[model samples]
Target: MPESLMMAFSWLDWLALGWFFACWAWYYEYSRRRQRSKRCLAGVMHGYRYDWMRRLLGREARIADATIMTHLERNGAFFASSTLLILAALFGLMGTTERALLVLADLPFAASSPSRLGLELKLLLLIGLFIYAFFTFTWSMRQYNFCAILIGSAPAADEKDSTPGLRKMFAIQAANVIDLAANQFNYGLRAYYFGLALLAWFLHPLAFILATAGVVGVLFRREFHSKTLKALAAGRDLDITFRGILQHEETTSESLKSQNK
Candidate 1:
């Protein structure tokens, strides 16, 4: 880069910004690997998704499954729309950057402020983060649409042409599609979390670094050791019980049909 462009930030500021991005990337990679081999939230939820798809294959009525998929797609759509609004607001903020800097300067404990150019660069970085989030959210929505189609095409329980192995394969493939969609949604949400941490950059580079680390720590705890994870893990472990419940439901449905006939 040109020296003129580099003049906006000190060496320490550059180091802090580097550390912020490094932490985000490092934690993302770590979580991805850990989830594959451990009982993290992602892993647990994937097992549930597998079960959901398997159960879906045996059911004649799929209103509940379709409704569940609709909810998931809505979540992705909501975030995608929100990201656009946030991007618009950030762009508008660029117009008032000088006034914003003046307000920051008046604060008693505020550290040495960045140049207007540096402030604009930071805002641009935030805009970039949300842009990535928006893309992920939209992609996730598309994947959920694929999952819906998979559900619609699933073999019926009494299909003479469909073997047990074929149905099982279909369930696994459908579950995997849903899992990929969910992972994309997670990535988008993670971007939002890290973007919030980047806001501390306006105050001080050290604050930015600390905030970034804090976000990573919070994410680690929630994904690995939270009460929600424990609940899901317990549910995952009760596979036999869940299967029995499904069987009971199937028997009850048959009984009701017979009574109506």
Candidate 2:
């Protein structure tokens, strides 16, 4: 490569690194606010909001009663979006490290006679990253399909009074939401990982490692160390159970007092 071209490439690489960090920081802050809200809300309210949030994020954007067309539409949208993202990440990997290694072998380095070992290492890493991206994308797609199925099969309001079907539907929807949320979380983590790899194209590989560690640390905090997880794990369910009992007691007391009066 010419001196000017190499310098330009170097500058572009640094810019990409800066952009990656900026985006990651923004997401980190956003995730923090979300976690804080989860911690502050009561169990009933949290459960309610969890359902609402799932619907809001869903592609269908509305609850429907077991419609085939709706399921197909939502699934198609989810698959399309996830597939595109996966393809983009794969393209980036191919255009960067894989291509760079190809060029590097032709240059004069200490062990530069084809460097078959280094080439194989680069190929393996690229393949692994591609697989990660594919899995994240595909799993999110599958979860969205599950969400579609849940929404489609939900019973009508009229049936709520006559059967336990409605409750079962809501429970299924809740499980689907959990699956969607978990997969979405994984997808976000994969995005940060890919961003780190992109940064590695410009900065030292150590920068990639640091970025990965930072992303993982943030995930760990949210998943295990955060107040939200602690609250949810410790007493949220108990509080909910207690609240139900208290409501029942209050209703009974009020009924007895009214009867005496």
Candidates' TM-scores? 0.90, 0.48
Per-model C-alpha lDDT, please? 0.90, 0.52
Clashing residue pairs found in predicted model 2: 66-152
Q: Which candidate is the best by lDDT?
A: 1
Could you list the CA RMSD of all candidates, in the order they appear? 5.8, 10.7
Off by more than 4 A, model 1: 240-261
lDDT of 2 by residue, 67-144 (tens): 533453454456446646665765665646656666665544312332343344444545555455556655655665
Candidate 1, pairs of clashing residues: none
Please write out the lDDT profile of model 1 over residues 111-221, one tens digit for every residue.
Answer: 676589888998999999999999999999999999999988999878999998998888888988998999999999999999989998888888888899999999999
